[model samples]
Target: MKKYIGILGLLTVAVIWGTGFVATAVALDNYTPFQILAIRFTVAFLILLGMNITKIKTISKKSFKRGSLLGVFLFLAFAFQTVGLQFTTPSKNAFLTAVNVIIVPFLGFLIFKKKVPIKGVVGSFVTLIGIALLSLTSSLGGINLGDMLTLVCAVFFALQIFVTDFFVDEEETWVLMLLQMGSAAALSWLTIFITGEGLPSIKMETVFPVLYLGIASTLIAYFLQTASQKYTTSSQAAVILSTEAFFGMLGSVLLLGEKVSINMLIGSIFIFIGILIVELDIPQFAKKQG
Candidate 1:
């Protein structure tokens, strides 16, 4: 039951993160990327802080260390992704960032010595193909600085998931969540200063989008991820969360009235199959054969 809950929670994170694209687009009209991230994470940290105030004193040093490390990965992922967007097309950035589905297993094996199940490994490739189909409308273009940056961003994201799985069982869930968010917020502000962007001035029009991103995407989605990763294998969690691409495409079609192509439908089908493969433990036979 906990496993099932974890699966559902990760899926929920995917859905909320999917909608975050829309909210982020709205917020971008008013704020720069670093500024937007700063506000979003700040709001999330504050809310979690308020809710977990009583437990704050009990948070262990290990939890702070792990959470802060995870926070750096999270911050780097977003920072590279947003910066990469300036140098590459959104399609390229999206596809490369989605490569986290591919990186998680290897990182898990190398960094944490976690053996990825055969089925999970297969599902990651399947998901990658689906993401390519969904995001790559153009031919493989020349690799640019943006593409490289986005690929690095994918590594950071994969690390974030693996590290979350690493620490979730050892620490208080809320404490980890709060510190991770707080660290990310702190990093974003630092980036804003380093980039000389200064702080962005918020307007009435920006409030709704920033609030949605803060509360829904950062706060709710991230907390769900932290709590849920406790019950699921990191590989399984990565595959499940890869559905964010599917959800994003779905939202575009449904809400933004974007036209869906045959490729899109086929890609979505493949993504579903990937998720199903992991969820159903279809690799048991493969393991037995090995």
Candidate 2:
């Protein structure tokens, strides 16, 4: 039951994150990427801090350090992705970002000496193809500056998942989450000043989107990611979370009334197959049949 809950939690986050593209679009009208991140993480940190104030005393030095480390990786991932967007199209960025699904299992093996299940290796490849179909809607321009940065962003994201899986077992979930949020917020605030993009005046359009992103996408989704990793392997979690891209595509079509294409339907089917491959014991089933 705990495992099921973990799977469901990841799926829920995937759905919410899928919708973030729209909210981000609205917010971008009023703020730069750094400014948006500053607002999002600051609001999320405050909310998490408020909700968990009574338990602050329980967080140890080691937990704080681990969470801060993870937060730095998280910040790098988002910062690279946002900056990469300045030079690349969103479709290319989306495809490259999803490449982290392929990176996660390899990082697990290389860092911890943990063996990735054969199914996981195969599923990651399958999911990579699906993401390509869904996100590569345009002709390829030779890999440019933004594409390279987005690829680096994928590595950072993959590290975040594996590192969170490593530390979650040793730390309390809520405390770790709060520390991570706080650290990311601090870094983002610093970047805002360094970049010389002063805060723009806020309007109602920006207010609602920033609020949703801070509360739902950052606080709730990240908390769920930390907690759910307790019950799921890092590679399995990566495969599940990769569905965020699929959900993002679906949300655009449904909520924004964007037209769905044949490629989108085909890509969704491929992703479903990839997820099933990771979640099921295919080799054991084959043995049973024999």
Candidate 3:
């Protein structure tokens, strides 16, 4: 039951994050990327801080330092994605950013000296092929500025996942979440000033999306993700979270009227299959060991 609940929570996170891509695209029309991030992170941080105030006070200095490092990685992940959206279509951005799933295992192997499973290597190749199919469009032909930035975002996101996995202790989930969100908010606001972009007037349309992005995507989804990870293994969690790309594509089509081509459908299937292969293979390997 706990595992099922965790799975459900992860699916919810994927859906919320998927819709967030559309919301972000809409918000971008009115405000710059940094401005949107600033508002979203600020609201999310405040909410998390309120929820974890007592825990925040109890966090040790070492825990606080680790959490701060996680926060920096989180900030860079979001900042890169937000900025990359400016240069690419949201659908493309979504698929490219999802490449972090492929990057994560490699990062773990490199940084933590973990051994890479053969399943992971095969999954990576399959996912790369899917990315090629998904990204090949008539207008774009090959990679563009937006795609490059989104790819960079994928790298940061992979690092964030690895950092979170390393630093998240049994005692400090809520406190760490609050600190990370607050740090991201601070960094985003600083970037806004550094870029010389002043705060823009907020309209009703923009305000609603920003609120949803902050509360739903940044706060609620993140909370769910942390909770779910407690019940699910990290490999399973990664597989579940990879569905965010599928949700993003759906949201783009439904909300933004983005066209879906035959190639996209085929490519999406490959991506799904790749993730399924990884998901099934890892658990089976674990069962064999047991």
Order of quality (TM-score): 3, 1, 2
Better model by TM-score: candidate 2 vs candidate 3? 3
What is the per-residue lDDT of model 2 for residues 35-75, given as tens digits with 9 covering 90 to 100? 77888888999988889889889888988899999889988
Q: Which stretches of candidate 1 lie over 4 Å from their true place?
A: 85-96, 112-148, 260-280, 283-289
- Lowest summed lDDT over 10 consecutive residues: which window, candidate 1? 88-97
lDDT of 1 by residue, 74-181 (tens): 999888877665665443454456567667777857866877777767776786777566555567743467767877888898899988887888887788889989
Off by over 4 Å in 2: 85-96, 115-148, 257-280, 284-290
> All candidates' TM-scores?
0.83, 0.83, 0.90
Pairs in clash, predicted candidate 2: none
Q: Backbone clash tally for model 2? A: 0
Please give, for residues 13-60, the per-residue lDDT of candidate 3 as tens digits: 988998999999999988888888899989989987777667665888
Model 3 RMSD to the real structure?
2.8
- Listed per model in order, the count of residue pairs whose N, CA or C atoms clash below 3 Å is 0, 0, 0
TM-score of 1: 0.83
Which RMSD values do the candidates have, in order? 3.2, 3.4, 2.8
In terms of TM-score, the best-performing candidate is 3
Name the regions of candidate 3 deviating beyond 4 angstroms: 138-141, 282-290
